[model samples]
Target: MKTYTYRHPEAIEHTGEVPVMDEQGQVILYSQRVYENYLKRTFDKMFDFRYFLKYEVLDSQREMLFTVKKISRRGKLWFEAVEVASKKKYIISYENWRIGLPTLFITDRKLKIQLEKEFEDWSNFLLDEVEIAKWKAEFSEELGEFHMTLQIHENSPIQQPEFFVGICQATLFVGA
Candidate 1:
């Protein structure tokens, strides 16, 4: 398995670049939260509300790999991630009414990826009833730092792991 870590400085407003590092602490990717409208972004930040935002994951060369956009349906929230090269779309939704740990479902045309929270800060990504990856998050309020780590199995079937990382970042940013 390969491990990747994402680290960023914690902030009240979630808008910045988060760097993803490999096991050797080499920067592998960067996830960036971008807001187009300054007024709207400021307003949302001031009110602690975020409805529309875009997140982009880029390679070390600064080439876009995938883009995630927050979308609303009725009163619930959803996220859509599109692979820039293939235009493949992944839809992620939250199960808000669950009794225990929050769950998220990431679906595409061919696969349905389920992230089942096993503990307060750990989750397992399952594909076809098999554990493909593990996710763990750590937060340090005192130091104002946040970290997300992913352990991906060598045999994992997911083609675009960056998309999953981007979705995870989006979930954290939106506090979902």
Candidate 2:
């Protein structure tokens, strides 16, 4: 049994379970554990999570670089990342976010598949704070598709109001 109490003037609060899928329609990593801590074993302190973009389906075939963004909080405050691929090697360009602030574009590899590491930050780097369980990288040319999942804490200190508390169970598919 579940009850939903809506909160107004702030973030939307609901008690319904929805598939936490990414832009590519994949479930957010560790989201299962985030809800019940049953099927998957994550941290006990984890609460809620969401997948923002999940949009990685081979932007292009040729060697190219895209300035990426953090699509999901994944139990962290801020995050940003990009998947780089070329004829040679593949790379994942990423950024750990501070907040939901306006992020700038990375312009070094404007239009090339950087063989080596190709990411640089300005001044304040805080990657150590974000504790990620998995950051997958896809390099299979035969697949022609890439998949990514992000998990963020729904009841962290940075979260406002913090409505992701109480008894929770992850949403599941039902057949009729």
Candidate 3:
């Protein structure tokens, strides 16, 4: 098994680059938040919170790996994961209002994403019933850092860093 980490950018500004690290604490991938429009950015500032955010993940070679976007559906937020090269979407997650938990929908694969603790909390989740990738959020901290032990499935097609990033952000930073 391998470990990876994601450190949120400095909060001096509302937006910055997030670094994805390997077990050795070396940067392997990076993510950046994107807004759909100036109006959305304005709303985020005016409300003093973020509602919708799109993250683009890039590898060390500067190759785009995936793009993940968080959107509002009904009364909850949902995530969309898209691969860069093939433009393929694999999985999407939406909240279960009855349990107040998020459930994943495997769009194009016969895989599953289950919460690590099974609805105890929203902070941690599993990739495929196993704890391959887990997120630990630190939103109230000084740097707003969120840590994770990410191990992308070697055989799964949904091995995008942005996918987990979106999941982590949705778990920690929900304002809508």
In terms of lDDT, which candidate is strongest? 1
lDDT of 1 by residue, 1-176 (tens): 88899876676356666788888998889888877788878776776646666788999887999999888777777889898999988998878623656577889878888887643567888888888898877887787887688888877887455876887777765553
Segments of candidate 1 deviating more than 4 angstroms:
97-100
Candidate with the larger TM-score of 1 and 2? 1
lDDT for 131 (candidate 1): 85
lDDT of 3 by residue, 1-176 (tens): 45577766434224566778877888888777767788888787775555666667778776778777766767665667777788777556554634544455535465676644232223444555555555554444555544444556554445555666655544444323
Task: Please give the TM-score that candidate 2 achieves against the real structure.
Answer: 0.19
Among the numbered candidates, top TM-score falls to 1
CA lDDT of each candidate?
A: 0.78, 0.23, 0.59
Instruction: Please estimate how well model 3 matches the true structure, expressed as its whole-model Cα lDDT.
Output: 0.59
Best to worst by TM-score, what's the order? 1, 3, 2
Clashing pairs in 3: none
Please report the TM-score between candidate 1 and the true structure.
0.88
RMSD of each: 2.1, 19.2, 3.9
Tell me how candidate 2 scores on lDDT.
0.23
Q: Could you arrange the candidates by lDDT from highest to lowest?
A: 1, 3, 2
Better of 1 and 3 by TM-score: 1
Q: What is the lDDT, from 0 to 100, of the residue 9 in candidate 3?
A: 45
Off by over 4 Å in 2: 1-134, 154-176
